[model samples]
Target: MLPLTLRFSLLALSCMLPLAALAETPLSTERVTELETLLYQDCGSCHGMTLRGGLGPALPESRMNAYSRDGLAALILDGVKGTAMPGWDGLLTEQEARWIADHLQNDNPLDE
Candidate 1:
């Protein structure tokens, strides 16, 4: 019923729709500041203010880099089972979690 070109266009749009949905909006400067504080204070409550490890394991850049960005973001949002690590889904957006993951992997204090 549809022209070949029309069908091809529809298929292309369908493929791109999922990607568009997955695209995250940019975070604001103030939101970034808040996220940084949360990462250092709230998450820091367990990972340590300096991220040197406390009740939770240390979050060195090396270790952070070991995880894929999306994987780490999922972990941040979902929390580990049978552990003290609680999910942040209630308090954070997926974009925020990814931002935190990026910071831990790239801008973390513990370079080693």
Candidate 2:
């Protein structure tokens, strides 16, 4: 019963709905950069500039094997008590915590 023009317009609108929803989601570039800077400044101070062994233990594959991305994010947000690590829940958002964990998970000191 719809006109051809109305049907075509509905089809186009339906096709664009998903993209419009996606566009509403904010990009996390600021959060990602904040995490990167935090790692380079705070963590790097103890873990070494390159994340190799330093005052803190090495963040090598073997050492990092026990941590999942979620686990690592949790650790960052709620630092290990009785240890040198300090919780960053107030300073970083959950997304930033996750970004740091993801970055650490992929870090390879051996890579040139």
Clashes per prediction? 0, 0
Candidate 2 Cα misplacement greater than 4 A, ranges: 1-27, 107-112
lDDT score of residue 71 within candidate 1: 99
lDDT of 2 at 95: 68
Q: Could you tell me which 10 consecutive residues in candidate 2 have the lowest summed lDDT? A: 103-112
lDDT of 1 by residue, 9-89 (tens): 999999999999988779999999999999999999999999999999999999999999999999999999899999999
Can you write out model 2's per-residue Cα lDDT over 55-93, one digit (the tens) per residue?
A: 776676555647988898899899889988789899877
> What is the model-wide C-alpha lDDT for candidate 2?
0.76
List candidate 1 segments past 4 Å from native. Answer: 1-19
Question: How accurate locally is residue 107 in candidate 2, as Cα lDDT from 0 to 100?
Answer: 65
lDDT of each: 0.96, 0.76
lDDT of 1 at 49: 97
